[model samples]
Target: MVHLSHKFSTIPINFIPKQFSKHLPQQIPSQTTPPFIPFSQRQNQRSLLESQLISALNCCTSLTQIQQIHARILRKGFEQCCYVLTKLIRILTKMEIPMDSYAKLVFNQVENPNPFLCTALIRGYCLQGHVKESVFVYSEMRKKNVLPISFTFSALFKACGVVNDVDLGRQIHGQTILIGGFGFGFDLFVKNSLIEMYVKLGFLGCGRKVFDELPGRDLISWTELIVGYVKAGDMESAGELFSELPKKDMVAWTAMVTGYAQNAKPREALEFFERMLNEGVETDKVTLVGVISACAQLGAAKYVNWIRDTVENLGFSPTRCVVVGSALIHMYSKCGSVEDAYKAFKVMEEKNVFSYSSMIAGFAMHGYAYAALELFHEMVKIGIKPNKVTFIGVLTACSHSRMVEQGRQIFESMEEKFGISPGVDHYSCMVDLLGRAGCLEEALNLAETMPLEPNGGVWGALLGACRTYSNPDIAQIAANHLFELEPNAIGNYILLSNIYASAGQWNDVLMVRKMMRERGLRKNPGCSWLETKKGVIQEFFSGDMSHPRYGEMKQVLEDLLNRLKAIGYQPNMNSIAYDVSDEEERRILITHSEKLALAFGLLDINADFPIRIMKNIRMCEDCHSFLCAVSQITRRVIIVRDNLRFHHFHDGKCSCGNFW
Candidate 1:
């Protein structure tokens, strides 16, 4: 609601004479001019003076300076000159000065304002968020029969978009058609602006209509629509349009890459990026960011190395590019390499909130709570404001490390000290922290009494904690709400079922399973990824022993199991949620996706390399214990990144200390 014009009110206004005095000659010649200077010479002198005044206006840094220039223009007998006045208005607009306060007064003095001058005023008002005032100016211009130029319509459309006034935008669109004779109706620039407006207002259909009607569309026209579809989460439509675009530019290609990346289609994003590179399309930091995001989502060490090499070959150093560095930090973290993430963070010459947050979250993901908290404090000490995501990382660190009091104090400080109100996500983090710390009642009470309504994440966190702590009572309460809020979220049902199974409540487990069956919801199959020594990423699924190296993989698991059992490592059968016999449970535990991935890693990956596995679900207690025992028996480091967080096992201990 703050007006830009109000900020300049303190400057004193000096009134200049609107016309020459009656006592003086109607026209004053230049200094030392002959008594009867020729008319052509006088005209030349005026043109030169206009150019000089315009140049001065262009260099003006303040409204007072522009006002002084205006006085000079009036004294030089160019008061009605639209050329200089239009330039003056544009300068004032660029300075963000209020249009009505000074520009309107100067415009009123002009006997016949030109189209460009009016357009400048219109754009200035629009830019200052005065859409109605700009529209009024447009109406008055029409009343005077001042046919709007293409720029005028473009400015209006842009303004309407800013204010989200679709009705006004359509009215202006009608004006373009009604006043079509001036050739402004079919102006390419105006059409593109219209498309941009519709897209910004979430009127993609209207934008497409404008695009379809274009007599001759250019790259900007196509790019605008492509980006519009991308924003709408319609990547299929965006791809179809992109495929039809005869002349693909980097902007259009990047739109597709970024669109796929944002829509969680990372593989498609990378494929498109690869195609773009093959086609020799130029890449900038923006394109690199999309590719980096895609790689981060894949969370494969192979892609990590590929991206790092690609960036190096392209001469894009992380130390110089904050965007690339921040993304690398996240990618490294997700790929189970917090050490590499920290290295990337340390080498960055410039760090923003994103870079700091990514690094903190990376540390938190690896269960390096002290390191995450220390970096957060460093970020704050250096004057970088922590956003909600940063606090999420901080709270997650506390949640994982059981730092309850610190988490509580920081959650309280979020609103009181930082002025950031606790949103539902923050509340969820608090619930997670308290629940993970075994205060199930307190976590439930907090979720119920939160100022904002508790969302699925809040209840889901409590449910997950219930599974961890074997609390079926609290699990049922959280699951009931989750069932209503996210009816199709199979994970909630699975968690509730697991909690029941762990508590020996077979009836309740069966009931939850029946609910899932009735709703036709199936649990997501567990999948895991591991990169081999040759840098090929391999995928495995739970209970699927169809690998070409199935014999070797099974033999490796058997050998490790035998070695683990010698040291008193027994399988945690409670991990299974179904009603199965002991033999079936043992078979199911041995065929887990992560266990298979670990076996594959041992068989193919170099001995010196840490066995890194990425899973699509939480690691079960049995698998977790097996990995710990394997790491100790073999004296090898095994890192597993699950949906929740990273677990680095070495010397018979996990980074999470079995707290997870």
Candidate 2:
């Protein structure tokens, strides 16, 4: 019963192709082994005899050799020695060369059950993901009156961490304290494990308490605290403690880098990564993951190529390419380079669930619903197990494409077929689905019946639905909830005011405006940006006059409006509060942020190239209709990413099919 550490596979369970075994060696070793020492006089030959037998046993790591050894030992009648059995376990456990032949054979036959043998078996079970079996074996060992030593308890605790079972882990903690003293002044191992468990479980207070109790600690103890703080979402404290450490191991360095990235300080994460490299410390998968995650968050596309080059140059055989590829895809996607993302996604040798999740998200972000759906199908074709995050990406695609049937199919399949219960994010996707497709009632019903309490995102999605269909009733209910939950969020206030204005409820709109002013909240002005041929981006806000080309941009806008009007386009002023005069409505429409940005594109770029615009909020109904008319008149495609879906305007219509 030789126990080995866990080998983490990047691919998910079901997604690991049938060809997985090809990565392993074909030959396997047997569990039974023979003694090399001849049976003779007792004490005189013991030392030399044991050494020779151990040398012979060491060669039996393979199933073939072990079976031969077993036959020879049984013929010699020396197979009953417990010491011989323990040595066999060691050989079997460490047979990393090929088949897990030892593991298979040992569990099938053990003459006498020993604590050491049980520990070895438990380690194998934990590595193989038989978490419950690991716990069961430990409990059975206890019932048999075998009090596990320090090593056995540590291994059991590691199993608890893997499953993230807090209750089972707490039970393990109780057992440990019962065996040892509460005052960490005695030993560091117990305290360290306790702290790591508590931190991983989100009990930061308990982790700190355990750390404080430690009388004398090593660097490993300090590393555990840093890791705990990082995992607990307290990056500031993690940074402080990490900088103060006299000796920093690779684990501590990576932990601090990962913490910064997770807490939205990717720039700092990257800076520290460089400093750590400069310090000439060893790097591993955790270090690489932290760097890749930081790159993703910072939209640092330049780092992707550098990482690829470095991995190749250093000849590193990484099991983490899947995680890296996923991060690279997300980085390109966030940086608005769909081409780069698609290329990175295609080159991955082994695609995991996260790999698919990232690319699908990239496509959806860029408004490539068709491309997103195709990639998703390809993910399924390759046997990746789709999880909740994967479905979020898929549902988002259907939402953007306004594919009502496909969206509904995925939403239902989460629990009905996949056995995955919907969380808040899943419900949010559904709301976006029905909201974009104009099925307001169904979307509202789904939100109201959400298994978990509806959060601000869920309510906000429903409010977006109400705004889409001009349904004031659902809008009011959602608005009230959102205000109570997140009164400081600027978007909700704007949504409520816009809904009021859309329905010709001038008094309500004015009241909402007054409330915002009283609360010292102001609407975020509409703004947009365009990527120029020069590779620089120019930003424009509503009523902006700071650009050097503002005069020329305004002239181009006026001329375009005149041409659009000539081509039989009339402005829709319905979204304007009916309480306002008609002249004021026309003037207000001219001052839209998107219009200001589009005028600059018209003045600078050729008519043949499509004018792409990204906005911070959903386009008003009037603006959508107006953009359609402008597209028809100018004979140019207009692609706008508003707060909702992508609007591809051409031939006098939008890609949303009048849904958005």
Measured on C-alpha atoms, candidate 2 has an lDDT of 0.71
Q: Count residue pairs with overlapping backbones in model 2.
A: 9
Could you say which candidate leads in lDDT? 1
- Compared to the true structure, candidate 1 yields what TM-score? 0.81
Could you tell me which 10 consecutive residues in candidate 1 have the lowest summed lDDT? 16-25
Pairs clashing within candidate 1: none
The best candidate by TM-score is 1
Residue 570 of candidate 1: its Cα lDDT? 84
Q: Write the per-residue lDDT of candidate 1 for residues 483-537, one digit (tens) a residue.
A: 9999988878877887888899988888988887788886577898887887788
Q: Hey, what RMSD does candidate 2 come out at?
A: 9.5
Query: lDDT of all the models against the reference?
Result: 0.86, 0.71
